[model samples]
Target: MDSVNFELANDGIWTVTQLNRQVGQLLEANFSRIWVRGEISNFTQAASGHWYFSIKDEGAAVKAVMFRGRAQATGFIPKPGERFEFRVNVTLYEPRGDYQLQVESMRRAGRGDLHEAFLILKEKLAAEGLFDQGRKREIKPMPLAVGVVTSMAAAALRDVLTALARRAPHVPVIIYPAPVQGMDSAGKLVQALQDAIARNEVDTLLLVRGGGSLEDLWSFNDETLARTIASSPIPIISGVGHETDFTIADFVADLRAPTPTAAAELSCRTRQTCLNQVDAAFNALTVSQHRLLERAGLRLDRAVACLVSPQQRLQQQNERLQVLKSRLARAASAPHDRHAARLALIRAKLAHAQPRLPELRNELNRQIQHLSTSTQRLIERRGQRLKAASQTLEALSPKNILERGYAIVRNEDGEIIKNALDLSVGERLAVELGQGSLQANVLQVHALL
Candidate 1:
């Protein structure tokens, strides 16, 4: 080796910061702004509002950063593991001497032709009113059975089963097997939906799958599948992917959930929730029955207070008739006594005039005879009036009416029934007759009007 010349001066020898700055400058000079496409991972946003993440493909990954200004202008908050294209500038962090990309702007990746197709189908279906909220069916709060349409081997199926088993073990689950991927999946899914519809065995159906790439999830974007979902009589819940992923099936289904497990939750209420509802209903029914019984008891008490035996009523009327008879007798005797007193006064006046005594005596005898005749006639008339009144009272008596081949009809509650319309068929009625009482069921009712 040749002898080396020593140049140990401060300007000649390089420090760590100087070396890093020089390398950073070199990188900035060599590379201009370029567009890059990759999946985002390890994403973090600092308090200062700078986004820090890594953009990775299958083979490699590179650190990237987007400042607050650019991130705000992008009008989107990026989720981890989403594929996007970044317009970035290659640079190095001088302090750490690390190479990285400064993202100027970003957009969804691989959204060219597939995105256009998605938009076209979405617009067609939306215009056809398939996405209208008014047209969607309501999910049953308590489904008797739940049917799942998905591949048997999918992880999403496992997730759904697990969730349903945990939440609603009492509910039966039926699986309609169909592939959720591959080229022929769309047709198979449509057929499965049709089969579920034809069977009509389940109250709600769940269509679910795990998250995947755009092409991997493309089968769910089929127009025929969307139409099939729309036509399903059973309410369908679509849980096709992660929270950010969406498909045509999601738009057409009756309800949409963010994940497979969420779809299972939406399919029906949990076992505890159903039990709570049942308990509440039972409590309400019990309270209602108690109130009804209380009302019925009060009504029965009132009816009992107003109700009287026919014998007792007849006895009361007989007592009233006796009182009226006594009053009539007293009135008839009072008039007779008054007329006798007037006759006595006339006889005293005749005694005072002795000369005309003989004629007066003859006149007095005739007058007495007339008075006797009038008194007898008045007594006869009073007796006739009393007899007529008694006869009228007897004729109008309820007991006499019942005796004349008539009955007093009453309801089960002991309410007197005056109209046939007050009774209904099969209702029990109490019929009171002259001698006995009978219980009868109404065969029919005829309105007089």
Candidate 2:
């Protein structure tokens, strides 16, 4: 604001090296590891084992370096026009102040954008439940025939044929050729799938292609191809690439094989294995039949043990009848014997129970005589008692008392007057004596003083 301190500010000015170093540090500190996708250009492998290249998209290009350590790990030699995705570090060259990327690793554009698209479609179909294991149909272990969808020129077809011939030569193989690469390859693949399905000749369909770079294999990543595979009624075995490669078709298929040959091996059993199984089944059937015949023989032996001739059966029945006849004769004689014993016992009991008439008559006479004496005694005793009672009653009788010189006087109404006051003077009364009765009249009544 006052005088400019130009000399002082100049003294604080930073050197070029320091400035570039600080800027580089700042760039590295601010930007983490990043990803870049573009066509590779100006690629050179330095004698010092470093890769120098420029990655440019439609609008932008950046210098990039992959050191020997990272470049060798890529396992791919970079081509100028080829596209690649790289994981890189942001940095600036200290000397030139030029910003560039240090590549950590590289992936052929195979799993980059198309892989992302593949992932997106896979996730979408997965969410819609198209990739559900339950929705996938089972591939027949013993298919009647197999349909192949691939280019006739593809080496994968030859590999599949060799595998099927070696493992199961009897199984039929039908080839539906389609371009395995190029712009319209996915459409041809879908048409081939439709053709195989319409014919309905094969139980299993192999959708196969040989391994290639991601761009070369992009047809297998098509959404239409993936949808066609998912919707196909035939069980599809997706053998689109090497073991390390994956495509959208793999996720939607009923089965995914690492290679086309592997898909053939998975589809059916080997001829030797089939023969072994058949021989085992035949041996088991033979053993079962032998055991069954042995059991039948044992059962027949037991039946023979129980079998008796008709003559023996009749002889046994006759013996039983003879025993029964002897028992019947004994049973018939037992009642007569039992009756004889019962009659003997009854005779003895009757003899014991019989009454002796003479003795009974004697006893009856004796009882009658005793009863006569007892009756005479009872009558005499009764007579004496009656005489005594009569004497007592006569003594107690008023007539008897009158006979003893006492008299009963009655009033005129024939009531005995108990007191002299009961008689009125000149009242007539009657007096009854022991022998007679008399009527009297009271001349006067007197009160005893």
Candidate 3:
């Protein structure tokens, strides 16, 4: 029989590229964006900033790729063997005819049903006031002893022991053995909590365990165990798993610590803190002692200032009398000494500036002669200036014009009459000539153009 042929059509032959392209389009159109949860593996990044990886569960696996832009937007780079949920698009690689997922985004995987149960239980307990701050008791900052509830063989117990020994060695640690994992661990944990409370040997209790998956930490989420922790007379510190993990016990306990050792540390004051308090107290005492010493020294100085013996008083009086006698003697001779100093200053000045009366008299006589000559010459010069001024005035004088037959007439009001209208008929006028003024009367009303 001839080999069967899977061709595109009888009329036309289709190439491998054409077939792969058509299949890829069909796969892309048929499948919508989906979510896939699995463990990451074979993760690698290219220099071009693209990611290539495979996501697998227990049985199946799929090749996935995230482009540079989408990978950058995810903000997290996935490592091999880490579990994450991926959002992807199903498509075939047309070049190789291979089916793979194009990853859009990725997130850490959720805890599934166990996580849902955890949320429900947490909400229920919170609504019932189990997580209320008012219902929780305060853990003493300085406890006398700390009791731990954990399996003696577990690593959590060892972590708690190490922390207690290092931080608060003075506080005794009482270990109450209890199973920290498995299905039956919750019952044993409740019993241990109850026993610690009844014994009253410790003021604070630590309920701790190492980090694990949600299933491994499920025992601490038991409703009965959380209720018991909340009701404990001694304050409980729950340190279940890592800081990222929170069990029901964490909410129910008086305080929640991130780890087993941290719970133990919370049970009492640290050694360093106690040392700091001691140093502070010592400094306060030293300062107080210094203040007291200063006060005492001040009192002694005041007493010394007030003290005066009889001999010392007599010496002070004698010194004061000597000072008074010296002052009185100086005061008594003060007028004479001041007069003597003034006389000496006058004598020194007289000697420095000795006057010659005969020479001064001769100089004065010569000055008087010179002044008389100078006054005569000045008088002659002034007379010449006055003569010149008189000549100019004579040339510009109206008396000259008046002497040339021009007369200046004034009305009765003493105003010079320039127009005939200003001089009315029968008006008295003063006529000024070259040598004198004559009073006249207007006799006729003579009008002239």
Candidate 4:
């Protein structure tokens, strides 16, 4: 067959399917996977678990489909009007030749890149032990002043201010205004941290920003800023982005808070709560002191009551003096009369008992002689009995046996044995003579009945 040549013409009519198929082929052949950034619209989640949506920007729009398998793997689901950045494979449906994106994964736009970077930095710092709990400095309970590094006009700054006002208004805040985002933000942040330290304006510092896209929060991930935060003499609290967004500053800071308001809350003491505690303690102390004073006062009152009064002592002395005076008066008036009366009574009694007195004296002398003789006999009997007991004890003494030329043979331990069976050759024995003891080892032993 002869080769046929045809010129490409733009006017050739084509069916809708043919056009779409051609477009699909071109799309598939040209692009395999791509990244797209746009606002989500016309979002629909079907019962079949697939997601169909349109991604559009100011200039263009494209249809997107996420199969159930991919959709389920994505950690987050998109809502209408939400901006997203996605990785997708571009293809065309041959039936309609419709060009569309088959999404594999999706995330909130600028945050996706920042989140990835944050994770990488976090892992690196963790491996170096920089983010270890042991390396983190403890925040002071009550800082005298605090330095705030953020954009002065940011809502985060305003939130921090309001929170501080509510929690600890007395805590002085020195604002170090710095751009929180964009190209040179990291440098500005480092400068702000160093400036606050140089000025010594604050004992603690707060590096904070409101929630935003990953790109919006890139300043916090700057290596220089991270190093500055790590080496800061003043303790730092990092509150960047939202709770879900973590930054390098969070790891290097002395403390991490989820929000700017939380950072402010951490930076200062709750003055009201502290005051309440102080008041409670003071009241308790006062009560205890009052109770102690009352007890002491009562003790003093009791002691005073028990003490002898001067008037009582004087009255006692006066009574004793009156008794002495009455006795002296009586003695002076009847001294002889008292003696005569006593003598007459004695004479009458003696006349009545004179005969009996002689007999009683004789009987008393006889009784005395009898008691003396009995005592002498008892002494002699006791002496004789004692002598007999002493002789008996002496005769039974072990020394007597030794004196009789009978030696006591005992083991080295001083245990005596009477039987020959108790002897063993090579065993040590002690022999007691009349005057001393001798040690001997048994040379031989023979048992005899």
Candidate 5:
């Protein structure tokens, strides 16, 4: 056989393997995983545990296979002529060049629609946090009364009553009868559960029913019913259907039980079990009381052994009082004696340190004479300095300069002129001398070059 590579060859020709491979790729790429409903025919399981079957309806048929992994997980074995819904991927078998569906999962035929609806509601509620374990309430360990919500005709109610009677006859049972099946059963069940909550008589409630198909048990899966169960103040235990069956109520309830009898059993403790708990508590309390009494007696014995006679205590106190009285007498007189001695010593010191008035007067007169002499010398020296300062001021006087034969010239504005160029022709000038002042006019300007 010649193999033609589709990418390299210009002419479109290929072997059986190549054609089948290309066809399988196209089918897988164009189609997604899909669910197909049909009746099974020609079903066979291979020695290797793979399943080969044909699914057909009245009009058409398709060949399919479930590999060992998926086949073993289905739980329900496929039989000829039985209808089922298969989730599959479309593919072509390269060896036989045959088109078939690769089965991924399987379910009963009619359940596809209900199961899909069930999944949609479950996801919606789960996203809203209804199914979270943290939000779920704990079942009461000892319920005063157990409430049952089921149809009056339901056998589940009888089972619950029987179990409750056997385990906890002391606990009362409240019946809230409602249809467990049929149209609008969910509404009736919700009303019943609400009544139980309103009465508040029961500590635990059981929503129970016998096992049935998905459609038959759909009342327990209602959204409104699930919401009611979630919001219930009293803890609810859902025991609907068999151990293998599940409902939305099961997820939303405070607790889930496998059977109706199981829900009753969980509602309260058995009578014998309660008796045993009381006995254990009584025994513990008795032991605690005995231990406390023994400890108290031991403490009393120690206190008695340490007791002292009142006569001895009084004698010891009298001795302490006498010692205190002697200290008081010494303390009262010693301060006075010490003060009198100190006074006498201070008087003797005062006499020895007395000042002499005549000697003090003489010393003061000498100091006064010395001070008078110092003042006279200071005045004479200051007078000589004053005379020198007067002479210096007379030398720097302007009148003295005029007296030395120097004359001062001033412009008409009375500004003094130092240069001959400062005098303009025909400008009046003031002449200043030692004794008088006179005005003159410039006849001619003289400049020495």
Candidate 6:
């Protein structure tokens, strides 16, 4: 036991393939799957349908490959230098022993702080019915007054004031200043909103704030503030942050605006547009009144004209009655005399014409007979010409060709062949006869001069 011999065998250097295989096996055992977030660089698509790229962060980088099949399934190719989060499986090429990631999927990360928050809040509120179309109140066309709840120091307040002044100066604004951010912001905002409602100072309340980071705008996400906004007696318009950013207040409020400025614009109607409409309506009413008055004046003038002097009217009526009496006397005496004179004249003419009456009748009858004979001849000539034209049309008809013993030969595709050169042997053709058609194949073609 004390003299036991120890022997060490010398082995030859390992080949590249063996070393690579060992490395690959170790990598497969250690990192089977992983997720990495980095900027893509040196992207290339080979003719062999393999994608090669490097995913690098500030400190380090790693090689990546997405086979054609996986890349195609992704629906879109990632561009170089674009930042993405990738889910990949770690592996080493057995032959080369290179450490690389085999990417399975990818997605964009951190679009912006506001966008991320917007997405999160939107998903959360959508489940709560705050954005339900059924629950949304319709804004009145003309409100008596509008309450503005915003940070007095905010530039957004100034923009709103300017817009309201220019658009509808008649509608007054009751401003309730609130802290838009930081620790005390939520409490101040809720108090301001409650005050505005308690005082009944406005028909509508605009809760607005300028855009800021998620942390800077954390007050808007307060549960108390959201509940307060939802229970507000007056309709609330929550306009906070940029178009991409969303908050709990946006969902709880009656209306959501992309920006504070947009909220102000939506809160009230423009003075100029309203004034123009009212002026138009007033002008139309005035014109209608003026037209009515003119019509009434014209009716009065006509009434006055019709009420002429009674004495003059009586004299005019007497003159007309006298003329009518004279006319009636003359009309009563003239008709009998005219009738007697006409009877005498007619009797004299009849006596003179009685001898020639029989001769004239005979001459008229003869002339009528000649006219009938000539008309019969002309009609017969026209009938014969018409008969010939009809026969010519019939002779040229396709039905006539079929009646005659000739038939048309058509190809399978319905094209007619007039000459032997138009057909080939073994081609399918149709022969038309008067009664039916025969399907046949062209055995041969022959030409005739």
Question: Against the true structure, whose TM-score is highest?
Answer: 5
Clashing pairs in 5: none
Q: What is the lDDT of candidate 5?
A: 0.82
* C-alpha lDDT values of all predictions: 0.83, 0.79, 0.80, 0.78, 0.82, 0.74
TM-scores of the candidates in the order shown = 0.54, 0.54, 0.48, 0.48, 0.56, 0.46
Tens digit per residue, CA lDDT, model 6, 1-449:
12323233357567677667666666666666666889999999999888999999899999999898887655346677778878788888775667899998676555444434555665677688766767777665567888889887787787777677666666778899998987788899889988998999798888888877556777888767877877777888888888866677887788889887788778877756765675676567557656765675676567557754546655665665567556555666668777567556755754553445457557756865675576567556755765675576456456677888989888886656767888889999999997788999888888897
Off by over 4 Å in 1: 1-35, 38-42, 45-112, 123-129, 308-449
Q: What CA RMSD would you report for each candidate?
A: 27.0, 55.9, 48.7, 36.2, 47.4, 34.3
The TM-score measured for candidate 4 stands at 0.48
Candidate 5: list runs displaced more than 4 Å: 1-35, 39-82, 92-100, 103-112, 309-449
Residues 1-449, candidate 2: write the lDDT tens digits. Answer: 12222222367887888777777777777664877789999999899999999999999999999999877655447679988788889899987889999999776675665655655776798798877899998999878788899998788988998899788766779999999999898899999999999999999999998998777888887878888888899999999878877787888899999899898888887867866775676567557656765675676567557745546655665666577556556666567877667557755755564445567557656865675576567556755765674466346444467798778787765555768987788898888787888888888888989
Candidate 3's TM-score reads 0.48
Angstrom error of the Cα, residue 410, model 6: value is: 99
TM-score of 5: 0.56
Give the poorly placed runs of model 6, Cα more than 4 Å off: 1-57, 61-124, 294-449
lDDT winner between candidates 1 and 6: 1
Candidate 1 per-residue lDDT over residues 44-106, each given as its tens digit? 999999999999999999999999999875644788988998889889898888999999878
lDDT of 4 by residue, 196-266 (tens): 98998788899999987567877888878988888888889999987766778987899999899999888
Clashes of 6: 2
Give residue 38's error in model 6 in angstroms. 6.6
Q: Write the per-residue lDDT of candidate 5 for residues 289-398, one digit (tens) a residue.
A: 56765675676567556755546655665665577557656666668877566556755654554545567557656865675576556556755665575566466456
Lowest summed lDDT window (length 10), candidate 2: 1-10
Clashing pairs in 6: 167-271, 168-271
- Candidate 4 or 2, higher TM-score: 2
